[model samples]
Each structure stands twice: as structure tokens, then as C-alpha cells.
Target: MFTPQGPTLRELAVQALSSVERGYDLLAPKFDHTPFRTPDLLLDPVARALRELGPYETGLDLCCGTGAGLGVLREVCAGRAVGVDFSAGMLEVARAGGPAASYVRGDALALPFGPVFDLVVSFGAFGHFVPGQYPDLFGQVRQVLRPGGQFAFPLPAPPRPGSRGYWAMLGFDGVMRVRNAVWRPPFVMYYRPFRLGDVHRELGRAGFDVALRALPELGERPDGSPRCRLVVATRRS
Candidate 1:
């Protein structure tokens, strides 16, 4: 679901054919108009949750494409705020439209910073990282956060089994699997591997005391579970 100003079908096709970095670089200018950008509906709840948990001094947004999460950091963080992304094009656009904050071009797996941040937030970027890479990714976030600092992100509940959404996601992942198998410079984006149970365990392994906060603004499932949750992982002091 894209807007009229979003990337064209041909543009999206080219992006899909390119590597993730190059693809985002190509899509950076029109990214906010695409459904791929973290919508304000999701970002608002996350910002609310962070405010209740914070008064944080400095904040960092990991893989902050277009700097959507930077706005949340600006709301909750009292002092410095920063957005880091691997795509120079994305960072350039972020610096232009995003809130006043520092923008750094850096890979999420090898963050170029010290344990200086009090809070870190990411949105819609987890799917870019495969399961096996979770350890290194979480470790990098941990490495940049002060002890007792938080690494937070919103995670939506999986779709109901046999539902259209479920089938759609499964089909998308299947296509991606086939594409990666045959393609070069594979674009790693898959939803199946980023499960809550597995992520909680990995966060523990990465030395974070994890907790989930319900984002009631997103509503609940038919079974009464939160439709979305904010995973707040605090580094152990």
C-alpha cells in the first residue's frame, strides 16, 4: 500500500533487484510515501511508552531509515539524539526532514560508538536481519548502551493462522527464499525468523533484562492479546 507520491512499480522492481543498501539508497527520497516507512500510528504509541519509561538523556535510533524513530527519541530524550543507518542516501534524507539530531552512517551489526546512549529504538528494521545474525545485532546495540540503558522496539503480533495476512506473509517469505537462492547480493528481509520467544531469549543472551509493554493504542486481538507490544530490553547493571 503506497501513496501516489510513492515509488513506481518499475522503481520498486529495480529496488528489489538491487542489494539492500543500494535499494534503500534508490528508494530513500520516496520512502516516507511508501508503506515500508514506520507509520505515525506505530511511532506514536512507541513514543508514549518511552516517555513513561524515560527521561533519557541521549537516544539512538538503530537503522533509522528516514529518521522516523528520531522523532520518538526527540520526544523522550532530554539531551542529544542520533540516528544511524548504513545508507548514505537515507541519512541525507533523514537529516533533511527528520527532527534536529545527529545522523551517522554506520552498520547496525558494527555500531561505531561507545556505551554512551541511554535509550535506543528501532522500527521496521528487524526483518532486514536474519535469525542467526540476531546475536551480533543485539550485541552491537548493547555495546552502545549504558548499563541500565534500554533497547526498545515495537513488535506487532503475528497474523491469525490461515488468515489472509498470514498467507500473504508466508508467500512473501517463500518468494524471498527463492530469490535469495538464485540471486546475488541477496536482500535479507524475512518476517518468519523474528519471533518473540526467540528474540526474548537472544536479548537475555545479550545481557538485557527484557520486558514487553502493551501498546493499547494499537488495539487487541480477538483472543484479547495485545495486537502490538513494545519490547523494552534494559541492559543489566
Candidate 2:
């Protein structure tokens, strides 16, 4: 769903047909107004979790579209915060809003920084990557982080089977699979593949010591499990 300020249906259709980079560039102007932007509901809790684990300097926000996660970095990092994305359009909007950080246009899989950051965080951007890309993606994050630095993101629990949310995600991913099969320059956003178990294993393989911290503010499921968790992956020293 989108606000009046967000992109129109026509705009969205055009974006859906483009490559991920071009699609995001097209959407970047009105992105914050869309449901796609990481809301404060998610961002605030991630900041809280990071604060408990951090006294960090030099933070980086990976895939930092319009700098939604930059505020989290600013809140938790004692030193400077920086945002990086492949989209120049997103960085342009982010700079104009003055999100208290520097912006860099760079690919997530091949970051252009040394291991200089004490913390790295991402929000609402993982769907762009497929399962096989996890190792490379995590490796890039680790490469840009100092020893003992953390790479963190929030992971919401999967929707229960037969639930409306479950069907919606399954349908969306199904549509994307068909679209990519037929379309050139495929847009690659899918919600189903970023499972917690798979991600934990990949993070470990990528040389991170992974831990999950419950975010109680998001509340709990009927079974008393957390609705969301912050995946805190520390670069192995």
C-alpha cells in the first residue's frame, strides 16, 4: 500500500520491469512515502538493540536507501555515520534530507571500503539479494567492518502457514519467479528466501559469530516466541 505522495501504479509497473538498480533509482524520489521504506516501528527497536551491544565508532548502513537506517547508526555510533547504496537517486534524496551522515554510491556485493567501521546495519533491503548471494554479501559487510564489529539487521518471523500474510508472500514470490523467467533486467525482490536458519548458517560461513536478540517491543506470537529478532553478527576477530 502507498500514500498519495508515493509512486503511482503506472510508476510502480515501470519500476517492476526494470533492473533492481534502475527500478530503485526510479522509485527513490517517492520511496519514503511508500510502504517499502523502513518504518520507525522497525528502526527504533533495532537502534535499541544496537545500543545495548555497542559503544561503536564509525558506522555504515548497507544498502542505505534514503538513509532510513542511518538514524539508527547516528543513535548508536559515537563517531560518524555513513550510508552506501548503488543508487545515486536514493543518495540524492538522502543527502537533501540531511540524515546526519555521508553517502556513497556503491554496490553491496563489492563494497569500496576498508575494514574501518565499528558497526554495520541494514534495513528493508535484503530482498534484492538471492540465497546464493548471501555469502558474497556477508563477506562484503565483513570486509568493511573492524575486527569484533557488528553487522546487524532485524528479521521478522515468517508468517504462519495458511495465514493471509503467508499466502501473500508466497504469491508475490511466485509472481516474481515467473516475471524473472520471462523478463529481461529482472527486478529481484522476494520475501520468502531470507529465512532465519539459512541466514544464520551463511553468516557463520562468512566468518561471523551470529546471535539473535529478541525485540520485545514488536511483541510475541501466540507461542510466546518473539515476533522479530535482531540478527547480530559480529565479525570473527
Candidate 3:
């Protein structure tokens, strides 16, 4: 769902027809007004969790659209906060918001920084990455973090197979696939592509010690599984 300030159906249709980067560029101005932005509910819990683990000096927000997660990083990171994304338009919106944070427009697969950050956080951006790219993505995140630094993100538990939400997501993914098949410069975003098991393995391979912290505020499913978790992957010291 979108707010009154969010993109119109015609605008959204045009974005869906463009490449992922270009679509986001077109959506950047109203990104924060859309449900597509990472929810503050999720951001708050992640900030609390990071605060418990941190007294971190520097933080980086990977693919920081409109600097929402950068706000979370600012709360927990003491010295400096940075946001990096490939979309110049998103970066421009982020700058206009005046997050007392530095911004960098760069590729996630080839991060430009050294081991300059104690923590890295990303929100709602993984869907943009195709399935086979996780290893490289994780590796790049690892490359920018100091030893013992963390790469954290919130991951919701998969929707129950027969649930309405599950069906909705399935349909969304199906529509995306159909769109990409016929469209040029395909917009790649699929809700179910990033699995926890695969993520854990890839993070491990990328030299991170992976762990999951339950976000208790979100409660648990009927089967007693955590509804959401914070994936905390620490680089080797």
C-alpha cells in the first residue's frame, strides 16, 4: 500500500517496466512514503538489537535507500555513519533528507571502502540481488568490515504455505517473472529468492560467523517459530 504522496499506479507501471536501478531512480522521490520502504517497526527492533551488541564506532548502510536504515545506524553507531547505494537518484533524495551521514554511490558487489566500518546494515534491498549473487554480495560486505565487525539485517520467516500473504507473494513473484521475461533490462526482485539456509551457508563461505537473533517483539508463528529474526554475521577477527 502507498500513501497519498506515493507513486501513482501509472507511475508504478512505468517503474515496473524499467530496469531495477532506473525504476528505483524514478521512485526515489516518494520512496519513504511507500510501504516498499523498510518499515520503522522493523528498523526500531534492529536498532535495539544492534545497540545491545554495539558500542560500534562506524557504521555503513548497504543499499541505503532514502537513508531509513542509516537512521538506525546513527542511533547505534557513535562516530560516523555512511550510506552506499548504486542509485544516484536515491542518493540525491538521501542527501536532501540531510541524514548527518555520508553517502556513496557504488556497486555492492565491488565496495570501494577498506576495513573501515564496525558494522554494516541493509534493509529491504536483498530482493534486488539475484539468487546466485549472494556469495559475492556477502564477500563485498565482509571486505568493508573490520575484524569482528558485523553485517546485520532483518529476515522475516517465510509465510505459511496456504496463507493469504504467502499466496500474495507467490503471485507477485510470478508477475515479476512474467514481466522480466518480456521486458528489456529486467527489474529483478523476487520475495522468496533469499532463503535463510542458503544465506547462512553463503555468509559462512564469505568468512562470516553467522548467527540468528530472534526479534521477540514480532512474536512467533503458530508452530512456535520466530516470526522474524536478525541475521548477525560477524567477520573473523
Which number leads on lDDT? 1
lDDT of 1 by residue, 163-218 (tens): 99999999999999999999988998998789999999999999999999999999
lDDT, residue 100, candidate 3: 90
Candidate 2 stretches greater than 4 Å from native:
none
Q: After superposition on all CA atoms, what RMSD does each candidate show versus the true structure?
A: 0.8, 0.8, 1.0
TM of each candidate vs. truth = 0.98, 0.98, 0.98
lDDT of 3 at 207: 97
lDDT of 1 at 17: 86
Clashes of 3: 0
lDDT of 2 at 13: 93
Ranking by lDDT: 1, 2, 3
lDDT for position 105 in model 3: 95
Tell me which residue pairs clash in candidate 2.
none
Q: Which 10 residues in a row give candidate 3 its minimum summed lDDT?
A: 1-10
Q: Local distance difference test, per candidate?
A: 0.94, 0.93, 0.93
lDDT: worst 10-residue window of model 2: 1-10
Candidate 1 TM-score, true structure as reference: 0.98
- lDDT score at residue 12, model 3, on the 0-100 scale: 93
